[model samples]
Target: MAVLDIKNLNVAYKSRNEKVFAVDNVSLSISEGDSVGIVGESGSGKSTLAMAILRLLSENDTEITGEIDFKGKDLLKMDINEFNKIRWKELAVVFQKSMNALSPIHKIGSQLEDIYRVHEPKIAKQKLKEKILSLFKLVNLSDRVYNLYPHELSGGMLQRVSIALSLIHKPPLLILDEATTALDVVTQGQILSEIQKLEQDIKMTRIMITHDMSVVANSCKKVVVMYAGKIMEVGNVEDVLIKPTHPYTQGLMKSFPTLKGEKKELSGIKGFLPNMSEKNKGCIFAPRCSFVQEVCHKVAPKEFEIKSGHLSACHLHGSEIN
Candidate 1:
């Protein structure tokens, strides 16, 4: 069975008497031990989907209707108390800024110990120390850095600490929301290598949320392309990245610089994402698509099977179906 399955998920926030849609009618699935990348331009609803899965969005002001099934259980239906039990133990997240995620006032050891003790309260002091030390080593951190303040560490070191913290409870699913965005290129490469090695060792499922296509190419086996709150394409990483069928996906690939092959000037996609407050009557990307047809501006396209395990939502790909 797939480890995570989202069905007909929709997320909208109440804003000035109107509901602004951030994620709309999206569905996806990830199997155990699969590394999936969610990639899109800014305002493409990638982060919103992550927040929805984690139940971090404000309930009172947000309308979220969906089935977020994790391991056969609907996370969307779970109560706060019940969900809390699974938050860090079964599912953990490493946000964008590592420094902000860490407490500025506390020592690294204390903060890590606090998190560890919450899940294993009865663990003796010596055993806990050993566990923390092992984790630090796993992330290639020295023992001396344990009692240091957050500001004492470099950006790369702090990111490693964040990764260590996420794995402290051995959660099967780890969501990285732009976890490497703040670091230098070298540091980002190091962290990606560490993640790749760690995944091999633990066989954990990971969801890497980033706008960088190169990052996805380096780390993920599968890729999902989103645009204007809906999925545009999803398939194996190489297939989706190299042979993108959707106009939006193809445009995104053209905008990035590829390391291999002859170098060419990058071309960016034209037009901006439409305002979320406006109700979409047809294809959300119709205005920006270079291949947009009259039918595209009048009717939204249904997802069509391009090949085995590959799907694209585009009127240009095949005959439209109800």
Candidate 2:
């Protein structure tokens, strides 16, 4: 069974100017031990989708709908207490910036111990320390550093510590929301390697949200491509990255350098995203799609199965429509 299943998810933010659909109707599933990467440009609803899955968004002006089933529990309808219990135990999230995520006033060890106490209040103090040390080693960090404050640690070390803290309860599902975007290329590579090793050791299900195609290419087995708050394509990492069928996917691929010997120009997709408040008459991506036709602007496209386990939401890919 899939560990995380999202169906017909929609998120909207209301404002005087317009109501923006940050995340449109979208569905995807992640199996146990599966590494799925959600990739898109900035403002493409990648982070919004992640936040919605965690039920962490502000509810004052935003409305969220759809079912998020994690381990047979409907997260959307769960009470705050139930959601609190599920968080950091069944599912944990690693935020984008470690510095901002961790507390500056508290010692790293104290902060981690607090998390452990919250999740497993009955755990003995000595055992908690041992567990924290063990986790530090799992991420290849020194136990002595636990006494240091968040400011004392380098960006890379802070990230590793953050990862360790997030895994204090050994969550079955771990979401990395651009966890390594702040680090240098070499450090990012190291962190990615460590995460891959940890995943193999712990059998953790991972949802990696990143704009970096290289990270997705190296780490994820499956890829979810999003554009303008809607899913454009989904398939095996190799298939979507190397043999992209949708114009948006192709454009993203062209934006990144290829490993193959062929030299290709890195051209970005033209046109800005549609105003979320404006009621779309047709496909959200039609205005920016390279092969858009009259029909594309009149009717929203439905998902078409191109191959087993590979799907695309573009009219051009449909045999009957094209």
Per-candidate Cα lDDT values, in order, are: 0.88, 0.86
Could you tell me the lDDT of residue 250 within candidate 2?
86
- Please name the candidate that would achieve the greatest lDDT relative to the true structure: 1
TM-score of each: 0.95, 0.94
Residue lDDT tens for model 2, 198-238: 77988888999998999999989999999889999999998
Where model 2 places Cα greater than 4 Å from the true spot, the runs are 318-322
* Least well predicted 10-residue stretch by lDDT in candidate 2: 313-322
Where is model 1 more than 4 Å wrong at Cα?
Answer: 318-322
How many clashes show up in model 1?
0
lDDT per residue as tens, model 1, 122-166: 988888888888888777789987899999998878987898898
lDDT of 2 at 8: 97
Total colliding residue pairs, candidate 2 = 0
TM-score of 2: 0.94
Question: What overall lDDT, based on C-alpha atoms, would model 2 receive against the true structure?
Answer: 0.86
State the RMSD for candidate 1.
2.6
